[model samples]
Target: MERKRHHEEASSESDDENYVPYVPLKERRKNEILKVTKKLGRAGRLLQEEEKKESTDDGGMQDEEEEIQVGPNANMSLLDQHSELIKKAEAKKESAREKLLKEEERILESVAENKALMGVAELAKGIQYQDPIKTGWTPPRAILAMPKERHQRMRKKMEILVEGEDIPPLCITFKEMKFPHIILKALKKRGIEKPTPIQMQGIPVVLMGRDMIGIAFTGSGKTLVFALPIIMFCLEQEKRLPFVKNEGPYGLIVCPSRELAKQTTEIINFFSRHLVEDGYPALKCLMCIGGMAIKEQLDMIKQGVHIIVATPGRLMDMLEKKMVNLDICRYLCLDEADRMIDMGFEEDVRTIFSYFKGQRQTLLFSATMPKKIQNFARSALVKPVTVNVGRAGAASLNVTQEVEFVKNEARMVYLLECLQKTPPPVLIFAEKKQDVDAIHEYLLLKGVEAAATHGSKDQEERSWAVDQFRKGAKDVLVATDVASKGLDFPDIQHVINYDMPEDIENYVHRIGRTGRSANRGVATTFISKACDESTLLDLKYLLIEAKQKVPPFLAQLEAESEKYLEIGGEVGCSYCGGLGHRITDCPRLEAVQNKAAQNIGRKDYLASNAADW
Candidate 1:
């Protein structure tokens, strides 16, 4: 038992020597923090050494090493350093952004200053920027201060007279006319940048709400002169009162022929298209003439139309049928008024005029003003301004006139010769439709591509033929007065009068087809014994006024007619071919007068015989 006790004591002493004591929680936490601090110090020294090595190696090192050295205990300190680096970077980026913004502002201010300086410089140079279409804007006085030579030329070339309350100054360029931007753009697209002499004066007068009598030659841009102002006025009206159902047309354009009406409608619609595209209300222009489906026209009117271009006959038909109305028409234009009257449309025109009740603006445009036209104007117009571009009934100076004294039978041969000598696109004028057909057939047989247009041909065929001629599909066009006055053929090289018209004014219009818009052209007239003596004298003076060379035959005819006036020789009576009186004053009258005188004598003789019985 003593040996076992001694062994137990030795074992207990050994166990006590190996046993460890329990520590407090706070003391354990303190020791752990101290150990982490020491480890962080070591990690910092190692990181410095690695950074030095990386700098020497040009930063070619493993990124994993840096992450491994960062212990969980040191995470807070590393994060704080990262936040400080981010703050420094943000400050530098903000400074750069501010500098850039300041530079951009400076640039914008400099550009604005430069623009202001440029405007001031332009003003100092006596250049003013004027908006032509601005209300109350008058024409610049500088336009009247033209060069002396230019003024002299204008006076000699154009006979412009303005008689009204206040006439607007003449426009040199189309820009000076103060058209809308879209209209100006359209004009530019059409290459019509300059205004003709008549347009320069006539457009403004018409816009002033005054009646105007524009006496200008054909192809003188008269269409635009009246058309522009009418369009502008209609647009103004549209702005005031939007289009309504069955309001009737705002403008009425009367043409002598269906062809002219079609052309005028096309022009109006062309300008109206731009207005529509620019977000304005749709402005529709309809062509109301014969030879088309009236039902379609009526439907168009029902749908809504702003303008109507019509002939007197078709318009009368529509008016009689009550298909259309013109009661609310604000503008009335009579194009080719003389021709309208001469074609026996006077009564129809008067009938149509009676429908308009309220005050309306009227414009009369004619190439010539005769007694009848003057009378019509006096009755219709209200103190209209008479604007004449040149002398009335004067031929164009651009045409070279040639009068050939050919017999009636040789006229065709002479025309063929002229055609062969001249270029393509010759317009031949005849007195009758049969003559035109005959000439057209002959030209076809002669291997010349030709077409004919007259009243007998339907409107479609006539329009097709005109288009063919215009497109150069046909070279020659033979027609009567139907193609004379208002048809615009730009490439007509020659105008040949196969038969002289009875009216000298028709002759002027016939040749007026050529030499239009200041282009050079030729006019050949075939004069025969059938031509009257008075016509010959008129031709002589017309040729002289146009600065054309008068043939010796016309000169001799004029001299022979003047001899009767110079000497006291008896003038031949136009009625009986007797001497000493005019047609109205002729004493040797008709057979009825002689028979009445004989009856009176017989009554006296019977009375004497009764007394003797």
Candidate 2:
């Protein structure tokens, strides 16, 4: 039995050596195709059975039965092999197509990004930073400084008495008498003898310790209107009680911007310069605005300031920190009330109001008092004297309205043309920071002197830019709403609305930057057919309501705005432009790197990247 088993095993081993396993590639391919075919056949048979039961009422079911046959009698292995090869070829083709599509998308994005960078660089090349000269009319300084020659001319044109009528000693309250004679003398030297309309109307009321509301246009001397009375009253209190009272100032002047606060403080200083010079109880002024260290302001207060000029947010911060005490605050002056509201400072205003006592005298001033402002007035002032200077809507009347219809694509070209044609020391306003930057860049590239002022810029940068604008080194300032109010550019011959304002009140505030101090000024607004209802409303508000003439071209453009809206579609690119590109695109992509490098050579990226990196 062992011998037999051994022989069988040997035979099996020899048979295995002689035999080769056949792997028919074609048959295997065919079998795979057949397996798929069999699945399809089985599925078809099941479907036929279902239809035979369902279509007992349909003649189409009978026809389907005749066409369907269930059997393995037919073998088309060759056809199956061919079909399998075809399927493989089709899958390869699809894969290639998908890869090609992905590559194309990537290339298109790269090209678009490069193109955007080039465009930004081109715009940046146009900037001409004109060095500031002390002799020239800088935008704000031209207006604020009020050159001696122009001042003399204005005094001549207007019936301004260099030596104003003196108030009766009785009419001049004890508070008024307490003011350092130096401040009064400075007012006399500046040819500001009599209080202007705002001063005359608002001052006596404020001194009487009443809450008053003064609505007036820019450069109507609103600062002195509220300031003088507050100072006088505080000085009277100081003199009446002597050093027994530790409290310093009873007056608080709240401005909306750092520039406005600074400008207002300067004006106040000028008025009180005599006191400081004479050394008789110097009128100490403290300025509190954002971008400065709070500790510095606190330190100044610690040294005992006589008057407070502050922005809302920082003041509120100080109040919270116990760095300031408003318990003794007897007077409040809100300069540029409209601007404060427009800046979304309503809550801050309310918060500050809560800190002051109810007995304090409140004086509010603004160029335009819309319904919201009127409501604020109702809440703030108690049965206040509402003084409307000029007309409620006539703020822009002092500013001449000129409108230009330009295509969206040709905005830069037309902007350059306008700048070239405009007189020196023009102020240009854009709706958005991006537009401000763009316009600033375009102007620079075209050899036009320009700079921009917006919230994005640091405090020092903004101050420098405004100073340059004020010095006439930069002939034009491309700015946002940040420059709309609280800015006094005295010699601005023209205000160019490179982009129309979003709100009518903003329009009044913007163009009002010019036409200051009874100086005739022209305002040119670039309106595209695609501007929104708000833009149109602002134009109409200026024309019909404000009594400014509507340019013939703006009327035409307004009529055709529907088509423009369809083309531009919206205010900003919802995806790409709104937040610096859409979701699919990485926000971290390199910006127009060389744009800022050529002009400033500081390698500043487009500000949108500031958020990302």
Candidate 3:
């Protein structure tokens, strides 16, 4: 049995060696093609079966077959039966194809019907699809959406003028202005029942969607005059386009200084916070200024903001980087317009205006209207309602002005004496940055808590000084003209001009800082021979116009004295030629006196020096 098994295994091994294991590539490819063809045929049969089932279920078609009994004399062959089955499968496939084509046509018809319904709905809602490429798209009824009769009423009440046309009177109270209940509540919470003169007139004009140039005194509530209207407009826009996240803000407010920008943003926050509490969408306000980090600002912008309060220089930087775009901006406000022009930001302002090409409501609030500012207004603003609350280029009547005549060498001594008598929280202004620093140092040395702010100081240092002064940590703040405009510090008792400003308009602004928000304050200016004669007459006029006491010396200066007196010419001590020190205080004079005293008994040295001289 073992030999037989061995013989079978040996025969199997010999057979394996004789047989070829690998097939030719051509024959293998042909076999694969045949296998694929059979699979495709089976797939087609399955699809046809599914379609037939669906058709029967729908009661559209039915298939019937009768079974035939095969007797001993049956002549049907297996090959003939297979061919008959194939023909039946082909017929089912054809029926399935026709059904698919019909279903496709039905689907197309349904889609067309849906599109038509949507178009009709849009038309009914009065929603017009504007081409973004052709026209800058702004939401319909985004702002100033009041009815014509109500608008006319509001205009008449506030004496609102549009293109020099007078409308009918409207409501006077905050509630009558049709502000949201929450906004009115916020105003009430702040104990602000009556609007200031500027707000009373400016609000209605802004609400009517008219461009405006508001000339109001400092602390006349001008900030709120523009801020409240802007907040309302932004809220309206937010409601209209809930998902819009523009690259830039919808409302852009440009101020001359960072502090003013920050102040405006705070006001926006104060109003917007109430809106969010009343179930409205939260309005985001960004203060983009030089001292803050640009990256953080960029991040906030990316998250989306409704309003942007920015200074010209920092805003220009962001604009150049393409981080912000004002193409869709609807409202533009230039706060402290005259100050911005005076700071040489005219070109920057123009560049910013060029970026906003669409229809925008512009509001310019300035303390004074200079010729340059007037020209800027003509070019930048539309037919705006000019609201002048008081006389232009005049100081506030709330502040009492006094001029003290002191020698240049005694100015610091006078400042120290003034500080001893006056209350804390004093703002001191100097003409030059060096003088500001020197005064700040001198005050510190004299045991008076003081801080300094100037153009030469870094942004961080300037902000620190302002913050310290605001918090009462520093009683005195010595600053240059940079702080003379649009900075609001509550309860500031006095403003001291340690050195008189060369420009008379600057003197007006310097004193204007103290008497803010109807608070009574005092402005004391120190006059010396070093001051330019040209500004004396203008200064006297300003003081007199504001009902301030003008000194006899200043009132007597001639108007033509400015042309004769060189601005920067020497006008100090004969010996030292230094404005801050007298001939008696000169170091060289002291040294010569000490030498002469030491050589009093040396006759030989005196005779030799005299002969040489």
Candidate 4:
């Protein structure tokens, strides 16, 4: 029995020895099959090659036979060989297809193992808030879409300068001001015999070397108020110094924004054109603003500038670089001072002021002078003439003001309703960056061609937004306070305050956006119960004093809102820490529902019937 057991164990050990480190029998069989298949492929190719050689021989024979007698035998041989070649080519193509499929599968497996999809998920997180359809969805096309005819008509309207019958408060007589005979002749050529209230008051005050503060609404010829005096001063000073080809600027005009600076410079250039008729070359004017090449501006400054119109930031930058010499800047003017503070550029204004030393005549003009500005005036102006042209912070008499109460969540919806109910080309103001973006998206979804401008946007974007709003490319512009000052968009029949402004003066500035140039306009304020409604009362009182009829609906709402605060008292907004509604819930915000309503039927309706070339 022991011998038999030992023999069985020996057989087991032999089996283990045979299996150790050797290829499995099943794998060996698969290798043999692959070898056989490869051999078959080689053989098939060889056979195909032989068939081609035979076909060539048959073709030669057929050509030779054609020279004598036509025969079907060569033709049948050629057909059979061609059929065989096609079969082989198709088989090779299938093999290549299979190889490509395998390679694709391997790549997919590798990607899966690496978890590449995780990276995409991470990327999506950054823009999730702005993904319209997923979050309160609004279509982008709807917001930017516009009716073609409306845009065309709006573009046709020109922003006329100084045209009205109120006998511009500052009309000038030929005797009061001392202009060279040449300037007087040029003024006559343009048919401008008298200056507006602003020009009349501002020109002489600026000329007298006294720091002056002129408060006037836009379209009151404010540009000319500063321009005429500066130009006349420069011209007069230039004539005094003979053989002075390169005299420093006799006047400097600083604006809050680039748009205002450009507009002011254009107005100066327009008035200076008459210099050609005066037997003198064109007046040397330099325009310096951000977004333009600094080197070019430096070169211009080096070449010498007679008059410089610039934004506070760029001008300060140039001054720091020693590119601009302020030693000869005897005359200084700050246009749109209120706007500079609103844009957080108060420090820049202070910096620019630092460059000036004793005996410089500083002229500061604003639509409404806030306390900060008052302090600036106290320090900057030297016992100057303070002329308040219009009622301080009162809406224009021609502007009819209205207020609507809406729920905090429904502001966007109310905005669209107001816009649809009102005329085309309405301007909407939003108080926050996110609110402006949200309103812009809602407007686009409503099928209203609209754009927004804010401090967060770059110069090009801001300018494009403003241009689109002005040219009627976009009928509505949702902007922050940047548009509140020095922005003149003609044909804007309505101005909607999506959020009530915190300050009463800002309310006036907001409404001043419309009812401009003696044209009739409407200013609507959207207020929610959560917002401070006292601004409405302040606005109503101011309008009443201005002789404008107050809308009864707003008056009733204002009376009811008085209960929220003590009589003759002010309640501050806890959210914005300001007196009006929380800045976050600014009355300037339009409701989303309002936006959706405008978007309806917009997708199918073409902006214009005119065929696009």
Candidate 5:
């Protein structure tokens, strides 16, 4: 009020009809002289007081009043000081009736734009995150008061670690997490009896409304960690304040792969059905991914939507077309976040971030978080709690890893014997689409029910293959690395890598397909001369870390890696998350950096643009 009153008073003089600029330079100079005289008078008095005090307190001082006020360009030794002072005196004074905060200050407060004019530009306006909610609903005192040592012991037992400031405690069970009755019932219906390591800690942190980075081995039920909470969140919001037409999607789940997006949407649909059954408001969740008709998705949003699970490309396209708006969207979860970056979706992800209307609760779930992804997380999410189950990029301990030296020609024959060792429902991962098709054909000729998925397969075919495998209709699913990231298949007895993956991270994800949901499984990897020594060395160290037996061929590499291993300790290669090699020797890191450079290089058409006449 005081500032406003002063501003109004000062502006009143200028608001008068007689207000005008000074006609002569002499008139402005007179006013500036008055102001400068007052300023210098005050400075001279203060300096005199200090000089007097010093002389009285100590010995007599000959020199006094040393400080002097001068114009910015008034250098003591320069001859132009007199002219600079004259120029300064003729300058215009700033307005006294200024805005409280400049444009830059408003942005710092998250007020990127001024309030819109009502009835003019207000239609479909977004909720500004001027004062975003930093913390979620308060948890029970017991959860908040858990002892640090008890938290540590629980995490150690589960082989999980939660690191951040003001981290919420983990829940022992689904009920302990204080989920709604609908959620509890849905969990029971899905047979999710207890929380996995990632779920235990991740659910609590996200439910508390904090941003999170969840890193667990693949097949550790990372889907439910975000799925259940998002269901509860959407349900609560609808019951409290329902969404109207064209006005929602309070929750979002982003997947790198379209198949994973479909899977997550299915889970949400199931829970949404449960919510409706319990007489809750209908929570609309949309799978806003590509390979589907955009018109149908637009139709769904016209009614209302509470959640969306989408891939980067499709989501970005929708945002660009103005078909979808993130005006009220919150609670974003990035599943297989590291894979998203690995697949070159970082820019799309950032572009998607620009559409967000307000600050939101973001969750990142991945099997591996290399340094590149870690840096992305730091920029995208708020202060986030990182809940890691087992080591990042570590192969699951539940899978018994077996590496064999099979010549290129002998792998096909050995694969038959390897399959015979395990029962039905085995997963085989090949690096190439052609290899996947060939393996599927060979398995079918042997009277084995099998399916294949790859980039060449359309969305429907890919989904059908996964469903057939999940339902036990097919005993085997041969796929490229597409299936290795975030697809959930239950009760697989064995996994075989038809050939070694190019990188160690892909190797971990391949075997991770089987040993999921606390089930013991086997992973057999066949390597020939085609496989390089670097990946083999990484595999050897990985097997040793998981306590798997080392083959005779890999024993030599193990001895070689021991010296580097001892130096690395628990801090392995922070760049690519490889165990045997440091960042200096990492192959994937070199490739990604080279690709990044290439992305910024000139296009072919631009090369011949010089003096084309």
Candidate 6:
């Protein structure tokens, strides 16, 4: 029994030597951390020694010893890579922060520049409210599914210039734009096989409920850009819930000229016709112009209108008279904005805006955006996308320009010769109304079929003359810049500038009468000593830029003006659209500045003499 107990005790002693005690998780973690801390300290010391050895003057023996020590800590090598990565990331972040600061400073500088020009600026750095229309928009599922690079390529191929963030995908085809079947049918009936560049970018953008400023070559189908989208917009509204009597006119198109209002109405009517034929709601479009019976337009308004196309004069008249209500109107378009602003219609536009009851999508379409338009857009438009199809003040490539140095006294005799350059169905533009009448008389006396129209003429006479010219009843039409602004005359193979226009922008529009719809045409301008040096210089630049032949007169003018063209030779004035002159000497800009100064002087004088009042 004694031997058995001794053996058992020895077994218990063996078990005690192998036994491990239970530990709480917290205590175990603390013990593990302490052990790791010790290991790290040892590793740190060893690493320091290794680095020191690497830098020491000692040779083979010490280098080998350092390598041996580093090899034992191979598992911890990721620490070096991890630290380097952290440094790189920190550097990238710092660079990004610097760039952001630079951009902010640039924005502030731009704001200061605007303050110098207009004396108006956003007062403080505040939260800019994003337009709900923009925030609310989402791309169609199919459009979203497209490869982003495809849209980039489309813009490149189409030569579409866009400046905005997150612009909508461009549509290559009308079908791709997702136009309604009926509207597509109307497009097919009109024989429009493809969408123009402006239409491609403008349609999706406007349809997405964003503001836009579109600049494209004349006759590049700008009207359709807004026209089609407006139709689609109204149709969607009507289909959701039919417009009650006098409750609609959900869209409005404002034009600078009565003729443009009439033409735009025709286009709207052309497309809206499909809606009714295919069992959709009747989309009524009214033409409100100066000559039209206001009572008749009012009566049509009473019957309920979905769209109204009007000129500034008549539209402003009705709005002020309470004959129209824009309570439901959410879309507004300014066609030929440059001419409209030139006619002093901008003030009227401001007045008309007072009548609008809510946020509206504003669109300004022009070949050239003037300084006033730029200021107005900055104040009014909320993140408007500027879609310029070509460069500023660019003319169509399809027009072959011919510049002739003809004396003023000899120009009349050369008129018949110029007309002979191209066939009938030609358009002639003169700088003055009297010049138009004189040219018309000369053409008739010469027994050439011709018609004449100008601003002073009644709308009926002008309409008849334009109708006669379009229907082939008259072979030629002679007019001032009035007829040249946004008038479409088919088969117009030739354009004659009997006198160079006072403004280069007008000259662009006058020549744009030809070279339309992919049809090549010719423009002949008669330059003489009567022309201003500014006009002549601008003409020289236009010819050279167009790659046309510059007569000796213009070449000499260019050489003489080389001093002025030394700076900003490649670009023209954005404020005036004059290629020959810089902004510092731009007559229009100078005149505006002087006028503003006078106004300010008058205000100061009034304030100083307040007691007199």
Looking at model 1, report the run of 10 residues with the lowest lDDT sum: 111-120
Candidate 3 lDDT over 1-613, as tens digits, reads 9999999999999999899788965458557756765788977567656855775785632222112435542456778777877999988866764564455335334322122111233334544322211112222342336576775565456444333344213335666566788988998886678776667667767777767788776767788877887788777777888635545488899998876787788889998888888899888888889977898888888887889999999999998888998877888889988778656786787678667646577788877764334544654455556776665555788988989899999998789888765699999999888899889889988999999999777788988898888889999999998888878887798999998886656777788888887789888999988876545555665666677777889877654322322222322222322222223233434555677677875877889899999
Task: Point out the higher-scoring one by lDDT: 2 or 4.
Answer: 4
Off by over 4 Å in 1: 1-157, 559-613
The TM-score that candidate 3 achieves is 0.64
State every prediction's TM-score relative to the real structure: 0.67, 0.60, 0.64, 0.58, 0.76, 0.76
Of the two candidates 1 and 3, the one with more favorable TM-score, higher being better, is: 1
Q: How would the candidate models be sorted by lDDT, starting from the highest? A: 6, 5, 1, 3, 4, 2
Task: Tell me the spans in candidate 2 whose CA falls farther than 4 Å from its real position.
Answer: 1-184, 188-194, 241-249, 544-548, 556-613
Output the lDDT of residue 521, model 1.
Answer: 83
Model 4 lDDT per residue over 1-613, tens place: 9999999999999999888587965467557756765788978567656755775888867444545544554446778978978999989866864664455345334322221111132323421221111111122343226554442343233211222121112224534565667667766765567765556556655555556677776555566667777776676656666324344666789888777787678778877877766665556788888887888776766666789999888888888877777767777888876667555676676667566533466677777664334444444455556655553344567777776667778888888788975677989987888899999999899798999988888888988888887788988999887678776665888999888876676677778888766678888887766565555655555655666666665556544323332211223222111233322233422232355557865643554434442
The all-Cα superposition gives candidate 5 an RMSD in Å to the true structure of 22.8
lDDT of 1 by residue, 469-550 (tens): 8899999999889888777776787999998886667887888888877788899999999886665666776776678888
Pairs in clash, predicted candidate 3? 153-169, 153-170, 154-170, 156-168, 156-169, 157-169, 157-170
Residue 442 lDDT in model 6? Answer: 89
Q: Is candidate 3 or candidate 5 better by lDDT?
A: 5
- lDDT of candidate 3 vs native? 0.71
Superposition TM-score, candidate 4 onto the true structure = 0.58
Q: What lDDT tens digits, residue by residue, belong to model 2 across residues 253-293?
A: 99888888888888777756665477655566789889987
**Candidate 5 local lDDT, 238-279, one digit each (tens):** 878888889878988999888788888888889878878888
Q: Count the backbone clashes (under 3 Å) in each candidate.
A: 0, 15, 7, 28, 0, 1
